[model samples]
Target: MSGVAGDDPRDPAGETKLTFPESWQVESSDGLSASVMFISGLIMVTRNRYLAWPSLLLSINSVINQHPLRTKEGGNSPISTVILGVSALLASYLPLVMIGPQKQVPLPVPEAQ
Candidate 1:
C-alpha cells in the first residue's frame, strides 16, 4: 500500500491521499510558528513584529485546528514533513540573522580649551 505524508491509512488512495496527520501537522505547525514568533518578536518588536505575528498565529492555528493550509500536491514522504517544519523554523531565523546586531556609538565630548 502506497502511503503519503499525512494520509489516512484506511483511505490510502482517496481524494485526500496526500493529507498530513492532523495532530502531527498541527503540532509541527505550532512548533514552527512558535519558533518564528520568537524570532520575529525579537527583531522589530514594534512594527514588523505585528506582520510576522499573523504567519506565526496562522501556523499555530492550522496545527491546533488540524486544518490543511497547504495541500500535498504530490506523493507523500516522511522527509517532506521534516523539511517543511525545519524550513519554516529556519526561514524565520534567517531574517533575524540578516538584520544583525544594532551598532552602538559613544557620544562626542566637547574639548576644553
Candidate 2:
C-alpha cells in the first residue's frame, strides 16, 4: 500500500495482497530530450530565426532517434557522424546569423578649400 517512489516494489507480509493491472511506462530521458529540443527550437525561431536552425536539427535528430531506421543498407557507417556534422555545420554558421546582413555606407568626402 506504500506508494513511495523509493519504497521496495515487494511486500513481505502475506496478510495483505496487492495486485496491479498490466501497465507500461516510457522512460523520460528520451522524451525529455526531444521535448527540450522542440521547445528550444520554438523559442529560438520566435526570438531569432537563424539561431533556431541548430535546435531544429537537434530536434530532428531526436525524432529520428525515436524511429527505427529504414533498411539497414548502410552497414558500418557512423550514422551519428552525419547528424553531428550537420549540427556542427549549422552551429558554425550561427555567428553569421548573429552578425546579420551586411550594409554598405557611403564614403565621406572632404570639402575643397
Candidate 3:
C-alpha cells in the first residue's frame, strides 16, 4: 500500500507529535478515576443517595473525553463504542439522584454575649 494519509495507522507523516504526560499526573488521574468508579459502583449498589450522586457525576466527567465521538475523524474504536452503548443502556434504569443538601456542615455560630 502506498504511504498515503489514510493508509497508515501510525500516521508517520502527520503533524501530530508523540508526547507523554507526567508520570505522576497519569498515575494520579488513573487512580482517581478508578477509585471514583469503584466507590460509585458500591454506592449505587447500596443506593446511597448522597455519595452516589457525586460519584456518578465524577464518573461521567471522562465520558466525552474517552468517547470515540470526541476522537479525530475516521478514528474508530469498537470497544469504546460497545462500552459507551452498555453504559447508556445501564443508565436508562440506574439513576443516582440527590434531593438533599451536600453541605458538610454549617458555619460555627459566634458565641452570643
Compare the candidates by TM-score and give the number of the best one. Answer: 3
- What's the lDDT for all of these models? 0.49, 0.50, 0.50
lDDT of 3 by residue, 1-113 (tens): 57555676666665576798633222123443456656656654665555654555555654534643334454333344334434543543365343444768889999999
Residue 31 CA displacement from its true place in model 1, Å: 16
Clashing pairs in 2: none
Give one digit per residue, the lDDT tens place, for model 1 in 27-79.
23345544544544453434343445455555455455433434243423334
Candidate order, TM-score descending:
3, 1, 2
How big is the RMSD of model 1?
14.9
Clashes of each: 4, 0, 0
Ranking by lDDT: 2, 3, 1
Consecutive 10-residue window with the lowest summed lDDT within model 2: 69-78
- Residues 1-113 of candidate 2 have per-residue lDDT tens digits of 86775466355543356787644434333543445455454443445444455555655565566433422343222344335434544555676789988899988998899
The C-alpha RMSD of each candidate to the native structure, in angstroms, is: 14.9, 13.1, 17.2
Better of 1 and 3 by lDDT: 3
Residue 20 lDDT (model 2):
78
TM-scores of the candidates in the order shown: 0.28, 0.27, 0.32
